[model samples]
Target: MNDDRLEGAGGEDTEEHLLRSLPGCIVAAVGMVGIAGFVLFLVARIVRSLTT
Candidate 1:
Protein backbone atom coordinates (compact mmCIF):
# COMPACT_ATOMS: atom_id res chain seq x y z
CA MET A 1 0.00 0.00 0.00
CA ASN A 2 1.65 3.22 1.05
CA ASP A 3 4.91 1.47 1.79
CA ASP A 4 4.85 -0.29 -1.56
CA ARG A 5 4.35 2.99 -3.37
CA LEU A 6 7.31 4.55 -1.57
CA GLU A 7 9.45 1.56 -2.44
CA GLY A 8 8.49 1.83 -6.08
CA ALA A 9 9.34 5.52 -6.10
CA GLY A 10 12.80 4.83 -4.69
CA GLY A 11 13.37 2.17 -7.32
CA GLU A 12 12.51 4.62 -10.06
CA ASP A 13 15.12 7.12 -8.80
CA THR A 14 17.78 4.43 -8.78
CA GLU A 15 16.85 3.36 -12.26
CA GLU A 16 17.04 6.90 -13.53
CA HIS A 17 20.43 7.39 -11.90
CA LEU A 18 21.76 4.28 -13.53
CA LEU A 19 20.38 5.22 -16.91
CA ARG A 20 22.00 8.65 -16.66
CA SER A 21 25.40 7.26 -15.76
CA LEU A 22 25.34 4.30 -18.13
CA PRO A 23 26.92 6.12 -21.04
CA GLY A 24 29.87 7.26 -18.95
CA CYS A 25 30.26 3.74 -17.64
CA ILE A 26 30.28 2.31 -21.14
CA VAL A 27 32.87 4.81 -22.32
CA ALA A 28 35.14 4.06 -19.37
CA ALA A 29 34.89 0.33 -20.09
CA VAL A 30 35.75 0.86 -23.73
CA GLY A 31 38.72 3.04 -22.84
CA MET A 32 40.06 0.48 -20.42
CA VAL A 33 39.78 -2.25 -23.06
CA GLY A 34 41.57 -0.16 -25.62
CA ILE A 35 44.38 0.61 -23.20
CA ALA A 36 44.79 -3.05 -22.35
CA GLY A 37 44.94 -3.99 -26.02
CA PHE A 38 47.58 -1.38 -26.68
CA VAL A 39 49.69 -2.58 -23.79
CA LEU A 40 49.49 -6.18 -25.01
CA PHE A 41 50.42 -5.17 -28.51
CA LEU A 42 53.48 -3.33 -27.25
CA VAL A 43 54.57 -6.30 -25.17
CA ALA A 44 54.24 -8.63 -28.12
CA ARG A 45 56.30 -6.35 -30.28
CA ILE A 46 59.01 -6.15 -27.66
CA VAL A 47 59.11 -9.91 -27.22
CA ARG A 48 59.28 -10.47 -30.93
CA SER A 49 62.20 -8.10 -31.23
CA LEU A 50 64.04 -9.88 -28.44
CA THR A 51 63.50 -13.32 -30.00
CA THR A 52 64.43 -12.30 -33.54
Candidate 2:
Protein backbone atom coordinates (compact mmCIF):
# COMPACT_ATOMS: atom_id res chain seq x y z
CA MET A 1 0.00 0.00 0.00
CA ASN A 2 2.97 2.38 -0.33
CA ASP A 3 2.39 5.08 -3.00
CA ASP A 4 6.07 5.94 -3.24
CA ARG A 5 6.86 2.49 -4.54
CA LEU A 6 4.17 2.88 -7.17
CA GLU A 7 5.61 6.15 -8.49
CA GLY A 8 8.55 6.41 -10.82
CA ALA A 9 12.05 6.35 -9.49
CA GLY A 10 12.69 9.81 -10.94
CA GLY A 11 9.76 11.15 -8.90
CA GLU A 12 7.66 11.70 -12.06
CA ASP A 13 4.42 9.81 -12.59
CA THR A 14 3.28 7.92 -15.68
CA GLU A 15 1.48 10.93 -17.10
CA GLU A 16 4.55 13.09 -16.69
CA HIS A 17 6.69 10.49 -18.40
CA LEU A 18 4.27 10.29 -21.29
CA LEU A 19 4.15 14.08 -21.57
CA ARG A 20 7.93 14.31 -21.67
CA SER A 21 8.13 11.61 -24.32
CA LEU A 22 5.23 12.96 -26.40
CA PRO A 23 7.40 15.10 -28.65
CA GLY A 24 9.80 12.29 -29.42
CA CYS A 25 6.92 9.96 -30.09
CA ILE A 26 5.36 12.47 -32.48
CA VAL A 27 8.62 12.92 -34.35
CA ALA A 28 9.08 9.18 -34.65
CA ALA A 29 5.53 8.73 -35.94
CA VAL A 30 5.99 11.47 -38.51
CA GLY A 31 9.28 10.03 -39.67
CA MET A 32 7.75 6.60 -40.08
CA VAL A 33 4.90 8.02 -42.16
CA GLY A 34 7.31 10.00 -44.31
CA ILE A 35 9.43 6.93 -44.98
CA ALA A 36 6.36 4.87 -45.82
CA GLY A 37 5.13 7.55 -48.22
CA PHE A 38 8.49 7.69 -49.94
CA VAL A 39 8.58 3.93 -50.34
CA LEU A 40 5.07 3.90 -51.80
CA PHE A 41 5.98 6.68 -54.18
CA LEU A 42 8.99 4.74 -55.41
CA VAL A 43 6.89 1.64 -55.85
CA ALA A 44 4.30 3.53 -57.86
CA ARG A 45 6.97 5.04 -60.06
CA ILE A 46 8.47 1.61 -60.74
CA VAL A 47 5.07 0.19 -61.58
CA ARG A 48 4.31 3.05 -63.93
CA SER A 49 7.60 2.58 -65.72
CA LEU A 50 7.00 -1.14 -66.12
CA THR A 51 3.50 -0.60 -67.49
CA THR A 52 4.51 2.16 -69.88
Candidate 3:
Protein backbone atom coordinates (compact mmCIF):
# COMPACT_ATOMS: atom_id res chain seq x y z
CA MET A 1 0.00 0.00 0.00
CA ASN A 2 2.90 2.31 -0.72
CA ASP A 3 1.71 5.02 -3.06
CA ASP A 4 4.14 7.52 -4.56
CA ARG A 5 1.44 10.15 -4.80
CA LEU A 6 1.20 10.43 -1.02
CA GLU A 7 3.37 12.92 0.85
CA GLY A 8 4.93 12.90 4.37
CA ALA A 9 5.19 9.15 4.47
CA GLY A 10 7.56 8.99 7.42
CA GLY A 11 11.28 9.56 6.82
CA GLU A 12 10.80 10.61 3.23
CA ASP A 13 13.41 13.01 1.95
CA THR A 14 12.39 14.29 -1.46
CA GLU A 15 12.58 17.40 -3.55
CA GLU A 16 8.82 17.64 -3.61
CA HIS A 17 8.81 18.22 0.15
CA LEU A 18 11.30 21.04 -0.23
CA LEU A 19 9.21 22.62 -2.97
CA ARG A 20 6.06 22.31 -0.93
CA SER A 21 7.68 23.92 2.10
CA LEU A 22 9.29 26.77 0.15
CA PRO A 23 6.25 29.02 0.22
CA GLY A 24 5.89 28.65 3.99
CA CYS A 25 9.52 29.55 4.47
CA ILE A 26 9.08 32.61 2.27
CA VAL A 27 6.02 33.74 4.21
CA ALA A 28 7.81 33.25 7.52
CA ALA A 29 10.76 35.30 6.31
CA VAL A 30 8.45 38.10 5.19
CA GLY A 31 6.67 38.06 8.55
CA MET A 32 9.98 38.30 10.40
CA VAL A 33 11.01 41.27 8.28
CA GLY A 34 7.69 42.98 8.92
CA ILE A 35 8.01 42.47 12.67
CA ALA A 36 11.53 43.85 12.63
CA GLY A 37 10.35 46.93 10.73
CA PHE A 38 7.56 47.50 13.21
CA VAL A 39 9.92 47.22 16.15
CA LEU A 40 12.32 49.69 14.55
CA PHE A 41 9.45 52.11 13.96
CA LEU A 42 8.40 51.88 17.58
CA VAL A 43 11.96 52.48 18.75
CA ALA A 44 12.26 55.53 16.51
CA ARG A 45 9.03 56.93 17.90
CA ILE A 46 10.24 56.44 21.45
CA VAL A 47 13.54 58.12 20.67
CA ARG A 48 11.77 61.09 19.11
CA SER A 49 9.46 61.46 22.10
CA LEU A 50 12.41 61.43 24.49
CA THR A 51 14.27 64.07 22.47
CA THR A 52 11.27 66.35 22.16
Better of 2 and 3 by TM-score: 2
TM-score of 1: 0.78
Assess every candidate by TM-score: 0.78, 0.77, 0.71
Question: Global CA lDDT of candidate 2, please?
Answer: 0.83
Tens digit per residue, CA lDDT, model 2, 1-52: 3554466455758677668678989999999999999999999999999999
User: Can you write out model 1's per-residue Cα lDDT over 1-52, one digit (the tens) per residue?
Assistant: 3554455577766676667668989999999999999999999999999999
> On residues 1-52, what C-alpha lDDT tens digit does candidate 3 reach at each position?
2343365564474577778778989999999999999999999999999999
Clashing pairs in 2: none
Cα lDDT over the full model 1 = 0.82
Error of 2 at 41 (Å): 0.1
**Weakest lDDT window of 10 consecutive positions for candidate 1:** 1-10
lDDT of 3 at 34: 100
